[model samples]
Target chain A: MDDRRVAVVVEDDEDIRELMVALLGQSGFEVHAAANGTDGVDAVKENDPVLVTVDLGLPDIDGYEVTRRVRRFTDAYVVMLTARNEEIDTLMGLDAGADDYLTKPFRPRELRARVEAMLRRPRVAQAPVGTQAPIPTSVPAVPEHGQGDTAGQAAGPTSAAAGSAAAAPSGPAGRTDGSSADARLVLNGLVLYPHVHHVEAEGRDVTLTPTEFVLLETLLRSGRVVRSKAELTRILRGDEPDAGTFVSESDERTVEVHVGNMRRKLGDDPRRPRWIETVRGIGYRAAGAAETSG
Target chain B: MTTAPVIDTDALGRLGEQLGDPEVLCGFIRRYEKMLGQRVERLHHALNTQDHDDWMDAVLSLKTSSAMAGAAALSQLAAELQDYLAKRPPDPVRWPVTDCLESVMAKLRHLARETARQLRLFLNRLSASPQLA
Candidate 1:
């Protein structure tokens, strides 16, 4: 079985497309290239790539439409590459289901950093056979304490559980069977399985992009503690929360958009959010049980 | 008057490093040259026919492809043409003077040629470098 990663480049411009193919190929991905949206989507379907870089402008269909189409079937990471650097374009691209966005003339180092940061997040698990996984309603065994390294390193379930166990005393709640219950966080009918990278709202599966999944998991684990947009941006970038990394306004806006999209996907209205609440000038937090019970 | 570089060698160098293989980078440069020729032809046809939509497509393509290939001057020229075409009314009667369009096209052609020539030189240097080879 070929375990090498696969990547698809959906760019109309031959130069950019070839550059991406070569770059991804060097990065150990089996690279496939398509020059138009139609062929791009087709290539994605056939290849089942783990990463897809798409250009905003295409001959047959736009990148937005292509992203929406790809989102229907796979959770492959989508990165939008566009010459248009306008804020509206960035917002639209992210809102249309792209996992990340890079403006044209972007430095290769910048692109590599973005790609590396995204790949650090755990990929979503394949859909379970038969019935959907049950949502755990018990208290979460892990609080995801510490604002930095712990959250950054807890990419998979075992690591998160292991970290939590090391930090907190192992009570009777600790399972000997190694069930994912130790890493599950439940609030107001929204359940997040951090170990398995799955979420369920009101007993129905809620599909989130890997970024959205991590954002929701972070908010849920924080309980009612409000996380600032800058902090969230750092978290999304895989930077330590307290690191001196400069979080640009665009990066903060991206966090806001991801949260907005997450709310939409979970069917939680911002005005009366049951899963996530806006903190006005600050950032976002999971809505308290008291607030949602009303 | 100072002139902007026809090619941003640093950008191409970074791309070469990211690609890791000298041969792959040289092949990309060759493909870029071929694609540049096709795009230039398309731009000339668009200008001759005054097809606003075709012009927009061709110029936008050139701008993005040139930027990716590190053709700084050509990409800037394409961007100017994009802005110019965008501001003009679609009606041919309201279009800019023919001579002005001709001058812009001539500049675009010259820049493309220079950018391609510099890329070829860069490729040759890379091919000849003992370490890279």
Candidate 2:
């Protein structure tokens, strides 16, 4: 059996569907295509693809519902295809559990790049088949920025995050450069299991969509270093939507909305944040891990 | 008549590059050719039944399919028509289409006819180009 990654492209247009399939093929995925929302959801269920792209104007059901349905059972990185005019579609797609939205008529290179960047964050081992993983833990309040070097070191660096077995000497593993793919990264009671893309806080599992998971993981990896909105947006957009794509201001809104939704899901109070901290006119910094070397 | 090309062959070539071959281009053209008749039938039904929603679906579908096929002028016209009808404002703000529904529908019918004629011309051009063939 080929253990290569799987990808599902859910698009109505035959032209675009084949485009997506070819792109993923070049990216080392066993690709599948579906014509509508119903079959798209069914394909995700059957193939358990690691990545999925959905169109907003699907015939049977809208893409939002498709993302919602897929999220109910899988943690695939869901990217929505939307027209440039529909800002609401982008927002709704993210809220409906999609990790990102690719504007239609996108350069095929952008698709490949975004997928490559998303694939970088790492994944956790899936639970046994037919068994649901434990419900997530409550999100603990993050520590104050620059005040948690001890916690950061205590969490371990490159080795800790690269190892999948949670039974290691240190907490779950998470690296700063995003070069490692270890199992879990535990920051005090806040645990990020990268292999399965699960996050836990205060002994409870928290259900974060792939985008939120990637955003939070990026913040956690960076610790006290203030990651600018532009930097974060680039991460959200994958490496190179820089020049040809829209300005950073538009991307700032994208990050803002995803961050807003992530905070709500984590139940972190924005005013008195326990986990992620806000810097005025700058960007967000994960309060914990002040001495992040990874 | 010296007219601007409705279907951009260069754009269709792009679609081919994305799909890795020209077969997809030909296949979709044929498929859309068939789908177009049904969609027009829906438009006729919409007009007979005076169902705005059905009319909306037809226009929207035509807009999307034309856009996918790289029917630039037709797609732009259909998109403008759909937007104008859906918004139903006093004036055309976003697009350069007429604000009247009957006018928009008339344009749609005209564009559909022209697009079909252009598509046949494009098919002939494709067969003649040995590289595309």
Candidate 3:
């Protein structure tokens, strides 16, 4: 089996395309290049790459449409490339499902660093949870109410407490034992299976991008605790929230966009959110079931 | 008049280091050189035809590629042109678009040629130097 990681570069300019291909190739990726958006989409479908870099301006379809199309099939990390350094472009790219964006004339080292950081983050497993091989009975069961400091503390009304019983450790912060892998978190009728990268809301399966899934899972695990934008930014960058990494304004805004997109997909209204709620001037938290039950 | 240094050798060196292969860097330079003419021609045609969309595309393509290949002067020129075109009035009541564009076009052509030449020379130096190769 070919275990080498794959990357697709979707750029219209031949020079930039070749440069990206060479760069990614040097990074140990099996690179596939496309000069237009149509071809780019086709290449992504054919290759199922772990990473994709898209140019916002293409001869045929724009990068946003291509990203949307790609998201339907795969959770590949997309990094949008644009000559314009406008904030609107970045926000649009994220809204369209790109995990990140780099302005043109970007330093090669910066690009490499971004790519490395993204690749370090775990990708959601594609397989459904039920199809996986069964766990042995000898393995200890995950605690119903985790005693760890990072465990979901029961908050809000009775429904929130009930929901916290199934909460698992969020990200690497609270995960002590491997047993948290099998834990299932429930909040306001939304169910998250952390091990399998699956989510269900009111018995209906919810499709979330890898970034969205991580954010949602983190919020669910935090129960009513507010996760600051800077903290979430670090988390998305694949760093421990308190890793003391400098969080830039742009990084926090990127988190805001991702969270907004996730809310839209989850049908959670910001004004009257059922699952994720904005704490205002702080960041975001999962709405308690009772507050949302109205 | 002699133009300011068309290429930023330092940026190119950094790119080479990031790529981790001198050969790939040379290949990219060659590709950039080969595509320079078409990109300039596209820009000229777009301006002549008053196709704003194509003009933006051509300018951005040139700017981004030049920047990546370390053609600093050419990239800067393209960026200026982009800003000028973007801010130009639709009616052209105050400033005559064609008259200004003619001068800008000439500058663009000269810079593009110089960029290509400098890139080729850099490639030759890299090829000859065993230390770099």
Candidate 4:
């Protein structure tokens, strides 16, 4: 168990599910594949894998619910996959106990890097003498490993078998304020920094205009649902609170034109988008969620 | 026959403080010249070929490039040019396009030269504005 790292991939699509498993397996992870949310929950409960990736568009239970459920039972990293590449969905995913999210049709390497970054985080060891953890004092205390009967404890052969059991009392041991300094978006090998406004693709920095940088950040933050052009313009300009919605109609059109230009600079394809994708009648979203661990 | 440049470095440096990276001023100078040159070259080709789509593309690129580089005056000028072209009836044969092109090109060159001079005084030497040259 300690010799290998295990990652659970819960996706309904046969091809995507198989692809994820193969990708993770090739990247030095023992892959556990689940077809739906229910099976995924069961697999995590049994496997105690170090990381789990859940797709939002599950056939049975929604992916958000799966994240919530799994979060309650284990400390394994939960990365949600959503098709609605909107800003709200990205925030909501974080609120639902997801460590990170990536939109569908993502790059295999990005997904693999996210999993590795999550695993590399030091799980908070049971409150050491000097460690400052807020574990509730009221819960009946169990030994160092944890309460054996606690639902959080999984019984399966651990992914990295020897002693890779996740640390107790999950809740992003090393993260703070829902943001990591090193947190960044990597799509199709393009690295975008949220705070720095820097983009690097194929190991070279791609300079973006101020507006382009703003647009990219907006897409990354909201890559789970379709963001209307109006909403985007308003966000960019910070228009009046109640000044009327029609003010941004022209700005809305500009958003599309600017995005078209941005796509050209990023070398993204609209016909078969491998990065920023267009939603027929709605708006644009970052299609790739495969982020590298910065 | 030089006219007073429209870009005021004092105002730009103040804006840069709010925008972070004082070097964005220099960035504006470099990018505006590079993009303006490319757009002018492209527009010349588009005009020769009578390609409305190519013309529009050139104008759009110029507009966005200026806006991003913090060349507010130049961007406004480009926007006006774009609006005029977009709103005016197409007369491919009688287009007074050369006049508009020369006017903007001259303005941009003056701005670029002025910006370069200001960068030398303020950024490199960290000095106040040079007395009216």
Candidate 5:
């Protein structure tokens, strides 16, 4: 029962697996890792981690299948590790319920920065209600071990885990609506609670990965104005949403996949979508969204 | 006149840092050395037995392992082998397949030597680092 957030890395290459384990460990996550799909799923179920980074091709059933099974049970953010040439699978991966995709031969710093950004966006669903996380709520601050900077061993989980876990309620900082995370956004029958990052589609609870949640939030906040894939990736990258650099085309595909999955979770057909509408080569927007933020 | 770098020392150095210990990197090098032989043999076995699926799997594993060990050039070559094997011939012919595998094998042999040298250099750095000790 480690109170620190958990992360599971499911990659076949030992080098990559070990790298993930080390990277996540240093960044305050209690990391569990595996070399294949079956074991990867097993670890996911056993740990119920807040984050799970999976490789696209595994020794057993491949990453797409692993994410499928995980999505059926838990909503842990699934980041797929893909080879650069396997850009095509990025779509397949999203269709299979991956939250994000990382090209292989990735820079360690880039991975860390990406993970940090993802962790910053709250994971209210995994916080097991009736618990209060400290300020800097979503991402625990990076630990600085006694030794000056990153020299020798990094202080994994110590500095980040410094927040006292004894508080009573689970809620983000300031809520315009109320103190109990009742911040709600409505798009007809679809309902989203901004504070807790909760979503309910047509009376049934919809399990959204962190990336999906952010995408949904961005669309809702933006109203009906069309957002390009470049804009969305910029949002995902923790950059100013309106501003974007040269976005990769694969990034656009990644958005398509995620939006596709999000639609499925909302039980909306792409043929004639009811909740999220695709703008054809532009990006996506929430259908008839009405925001009432306090 | 540029000889394509067999191994990316920068990648190797980054990997060494991620591993946190040069000795751990040395361990991977040893395992990679052994796995390369086994994977190459497996590829040959698949090709000789006309097991295209198995051959694909072997080459993919080789490619990933090469990338993991920072053998970018070799990994690229293995990826080419993967693409080539993906195009299955209707008739299982024993011609040219051996030639293709041999070329990849030659590259792998060169990469293995380069990988060994890089690991040696990384290990020496670890020994010199008072902080690591």
Candidate 6:
């Protein structure tokens, strides 16, 4: 009954997985480590973690498939880990139901930061407004004597927090400034807010997970213009403008999946889109017809 | 890298005069219907739910869509809405919903009525045009 959020890190790579577990653990999160997709999925069911970071290149089942499978039974925040910086992989992860994506060789501090950021979003009460609380699941508390953490917990010792603060600007993550303000997008009976990350359709507030809202808004803002896989990855990942992580430009089907999700929510037909039009061989576009269909 | 058609004034104006006609206005009408109708619907939904987050999202969308369709009044209104909503802890009083939303919808409907009704007049008279060529 600790109620502290738990995190499950799934990866075949012992070193990376341990690194993530330690990183999360230091932040006072209960960490579960899974070496493969099947184990990872089972761990999620058993632990019901609030967050799960998965590596895309798993030994048995690929990370993308694992993410898709996880979506069926859980709504945990999923951050996909990719070794190849391939834009397609990032899109695939998002489409497969991942809430976020991180390329490999990422800073451990960045991972901890993402967990905290995702946690900070005010969760809309999942249970209907004021019935009986659902059965409470057991949340494991970190043993006070445990030494399995790194130096970057958000509210840990001052020096450790300082190190992360210093590393943040240089890390391959995007930070929003108040100056740029919130972003807005209108497309085919849909409205998207990039700043707060919200969406609405046809005068009815549509519930979109954070990832879905971001993906849809990004596409709408780009107009009917097709965004390259790499471009969309940058936008979604919010990589530092000058960060030098190697990014693969090929493969954009992940975007297609997000587009497909958006289309479904907007009541557009996938095979024949009236909202997000498919651009063969390049990317997707928001056709004018698609926007006004409703 | 294949280049997209230049949407600049040089390109649009040239294309406008060359296409001569109905296609230009017809295209504008069709595009406006989608863009404006969607924007209004989104705003209406955002406002009805009192979902401040969704309201900002819809307003931001209209900001861009209005500019694209040459609905100066609506574009400016959308921009105003976006700016107001973008401010953290947004103030609901500042939204220009009554005039801007109604005007945008009306103008869009008017534009959609005919294939070509003073296309230049519509584009030129608007105040919130996007960066034109």
Fraction of true contacts retained by every candidate, in order, equals 0.58, 0.06, 0.76, 0.00, 0.12, 0.00
On TM-score, the leading prediction is 3
RMSD of each: 8.1, 8.5, 9.1, 21.5, 9.6, 25.9
* Overall lDDT per candidate, in order of appearance: 0.70, 0.64, 0.73, 0.55, 0.64, 0.52
DockQ top scorer: 3
lDDT of 6 by residue, A1-294 (tens): 235577889986554465466567668878999999999989877876678888886768988878766654454678898754456766667656676677654554566666765554323112211223321222011101122111001111211112222222221122222211123346666654433233456654444444455556556645666765555544444553234544453324444566666666566775787556767666666665223110
Candidate 6 per-residue lDDT over residues B3-107, each given as its tens digit:
222122343443334334433433543454444545566677665565775675456444443333334445455555556555555654444466765665454
A1-294 per-residue lDDT for model 3 (tens digits)? 234578999998887788788778778888999999999989987886778899999999999988877765555678998888888999888877788989997776788889987765544333222334343232121212222111111111211111112321244334322433345667877766655455666765555667787788777767788889988877777777878889888888888888987777667889988899898988998886322110
DockQ of 6: 0.01
TM-score of 6: 0.39
For model 3 chain A, the run of ten residues with the poorest summed lDDT: A152-161
> Per-candidate TM vs. native?
0.78, 0.72, 0.82, 0.35, 0.72, 0.39
Error of 3 at B99 (Å): 3.2
Alpha-carbon shift of residue B111 in model 4 (angstroms) = 52
Give the per-residue lDDT digits (tens) of candidate 1, residues A83-140.
7766888888887778899987776668778877666543433322221344244422
lDDT by residue (tens digit), candidate 4, A36-101: 899998988788776789987676887888876775445566788865445566656655556557
Specify the poorest-scoring 10-residue window by lDDT in model 5 chain B. B1-10
Q: Clashing residue pairs, candidate 3?
A: none
Cα misplacement distance, residue B53 of candidate 3 (Å) = 1.4
Give the worst 10-residue stretch by lDDT in candidate 1 chain A.
A147-156
Q: Which stretches of candidate 1 lie over 4 Å from their true place?
A: A1-3, A130-207, A243-246, A265-272, A289-294, B48-54, B87-94, B130-133
| Predictions' DockQ, in order | 0.54, 0.27, 0.66, 0.01, 0.26, 0.01
Report fnat, model 1.
Answer: 0.58
lDDT of 5 at B96: 49
